[model samples]
Target: MEPRQLRAIMLYEHNLGTSARQTAEKINTAFGQCTIAHSTVSYWFKSFDKGDTSCEDKPRSGRPVVFDEDLLRSHLERHPDATTRDLEKELGYDHSTIIRHLHAMGYHKIMSRWTPHALTDSERAARVTICESLLLQPHRQDFLRSIVTVDESWVHYNNKTRQAYWVLRGERAPTEPKGYWELLDEKQTINATICGEQLEKLAPEIATKRPKRLSVSLLQDNARPHTAKSVRHILEKLNWTVVPHPPYSPDIAPSDYLQIIRTHLGKELVIYDDHTYYCNVTSANGWKKYWRCTRGGGTRCCAARLHLSPDYKVMKIINEHRHPPPRFIVRNGVYTKIG
Candidate 1:
């Protein structure tokens, strides 16, 4: 039975002076046609009567206040320009105490950071115009075909601590879990791009064999280096087309494809076999499957067939095969590898 029901039975037993089981049976049998044991009901009666109240719910104790109502009200009215230390000095409280007061008063900290495409209205329009003119030109395809996307991003070497968790009132929150941030000395932020050189490395089959006749259309944001005269002149000399994106349009860029590629790449073992598969997906290219039938014989795999639509089930199978086997690998390695 629930504690509340037991408490209720106890209350009835205390007020009526009945045996615990009899009271429980009476309470249960009264409306529901069910009887609780008389002995079990008596235990509740003893517990309820021993305490000040028979109610199951307990009272809550709120956080202690650092300042009185008048001081808090005054501080709220004049805290527009006050720092935590300033508030501390004015209210005769410590910095943490002032911070707690501010939190209680519904203040939160804000994070401010900057990235590419943080441009003004005129700057953005100028970029969009460049892209539009290139698109409108007849030679656009010559440049677009050669264009490869490039960008860099971060990866967690280790799983970081989760930010949100459950906690009771007045209880301190737990810290976030740690991950890759502490590992490798190389760099936390990896600068990658599908630019010329990186593109060649990513797809050597095409990069090494394809001639300079392949003029790629390069799309980038208005970062300082990207907008500089030298950057444009280099692209022109290489017979490449530079298509600068309007501010904040990554959602439509080819690099957006790369983002999806990287996310899947990070979880690569879970979805793919090697870096080639990763590049293929991001390159807007198709796949080349090499399947074989074992003793549990199935149809021989299709070698050179064209299809209008892909089988999602086949993709799911590929993804399942990507991740490294788990517990089995651990068990097999433990005996032989561990000393």
Candidate 2:
């Protein structure tokens, strides 16, 4: 039997007013190989006599105790970004003890929210004005259904960050220096033309999947290519309503806030019909494969590349193209870009 079980039996004997020696004799008679020392029973009997009912051993004097909430709160106020490990070092407590106390105190670590750019007072006012105008539109739900948001981002040729790993003593941990310029993959900037035209082209198919009364309202940042005359002309011809947005407010933009493109790319294998894709040798690492466009004589195609995981899930589609997909392919009653 375990020490706890033996202690429980001792407590029961004490409740009956049995002496410590009598309890020890009864324990030896009931459980073989559990011959507890007589002195141990005497110690427990003393505790039970004093109204201690717990069967578990008492905490040792040297064992770590729960952290002070006031002290922890003050420390966090000074170092809001300090990690749990950092707190352990500073407060001289185990990681688990700190975590338990934090839970009891209702403290939780939260990541800082990311914003595309810090908004000035003027920008904030503009955002509010645009939002108020949008809300004032007669057909608000219809407008929302018609809104097609778009944004552009650079896709790095190589992973910008490296992961840490365990290593044996005397063996150095692997290191990939950020300053190794050659190790960095080429960066590509995509334009908004492709996104606008593709949405226009896909309108009929997208409509078939939804209610027929919906119209598309294009939402895009004020990037150069997005505001270009040619892009606006195409949007007008397609009859897409353009939604006004403030500069550098990606946090409010549906495309950035909802992460539509990122989620779409991460879930499926996507191919563009108009753009020819070639395997990029520079990014054929085990975790990801990169494919670049072959348009524009290798210089001018939408600077985007498709990143795929080993299992063929599209991790990301980097950059934007200045042109639309050359053609749409209809297969099995579904219109899809070429894969």
Candidate 3:
């Protein structure tokens, strides 16, 4: 039989107050074993709840309306967590229509996946920095195995095969799953004291595994326990170089690459001499920019800034800085600050 005819029967059974599973079984018995699924019956019942009795698809309007796909994509890129209702309010479109278009464009909402930590903006920004400093090192390609690595696992009280962790009658955490995965023993927290201890001989094992290359780079989280002075002291004594961090810090050098490349991302950014500036639009092909000093507004550098034309061949810088010059690397012709 046609699916629509079966759905009509399901709807009839639903109106008669039949259970979805029972209705499905009755239909399958008359037709064949798997002719209709209980879930399909439940779906029709839901549609019935919404007062939608039609078994056929909704008709398309005279001309299919076009959604501003670019606008939708742009909004989604900015606010990924936005829902259909949010989009409807922002873009002045029907939520259902927007959802249909979204599906048509192969976009679907999904539950946010769990991460070890939901880091703050600064933490995320700190993780986002870029630098070519590593490229300056020699033979980095050959040193992959020389990086210190270790695994962390729970060590049971008794050295028997721990088939499954059983929670020994303790208050379960609010978000704890009521499953066999619950810890049987009171789980021990790895504090600074324990972190520095004999965890698979982190330092000694690395040295023993790699006798020739004693020096190894250690990548670790910027946690107090992980970066304890005592821990660092012992690791450094063994010539273990800690991967001291753009991953662990929010401070940026090569000065705010994101802000520096603002213009590349379609933003008009005017920056020079390690300072952000706004352009004086009335100026010629050479943009006249205002210099922001340490002093509060309205004050300019003793020597006003200038954006010279390419036609000008020779230019001389005569002014001296107030303090010692910052460390910078000359790229092409522009000086980029090093962090």
Write the residue-wise lDDT of candidate 2 on 1-339 in tens digits: 788988888988898989998888888887754588789999999888888889987867452565577888888767765677888888878888887777676664422222445668998899899988988999688787777766543222332333322222233333232311111123633456665566666677667876575567888878787887888888788777889988776646655432212222232223432233555544435544777655556555456577766655456765344343333332222333333
lDDT of 1 by residue, 1-339 (tens): 676765765786678777665666667777454545666566666666677554656554554444664575576455443556666666666677767766776554321111223557886686679667766878655665666665533233332222222222333333222212222124532222223344345444445666554556666654454555655555666665566576655534654322222221243211111111222132235433332111122352211111112321123222112111111111111211111
Summarize candidate 3's per-residue lDDT along 249-325 as a digit string, tens digits: 32232221112223323433333333333333434645333322221243424332334234321132222222222
User: Best TM-score goes to which candidate?
Assistant: 2
Q: Candidates 1 and 3: which is better by TM-score?
A: 3
Q: Taking the candidates one at a time, how many backbone clashes does each contain?
A: 21, 4, 3
Best by lDDT: 2
Question: In model 2, which regions exceed 4 Å deviation?
Answer: 1-67, 151-189, 192-216, 236-239, 257-339
Candidate 1: segments with Cα more than 4 A from true spot: 1-9, 21-34, 52-127, 138-339
C-alpha TM-scores of all predictions: 0.31, 0.43, 0.35
Weakest 10 consecutive residues, lDDT, candidate 3? Answer: 173-182
Error of 2 at 118 (Å): 2.8
Whole-model lDDT, candidate 3? 0.52
Point out the higher-scoring one by lDDT: 2 or 3. 2
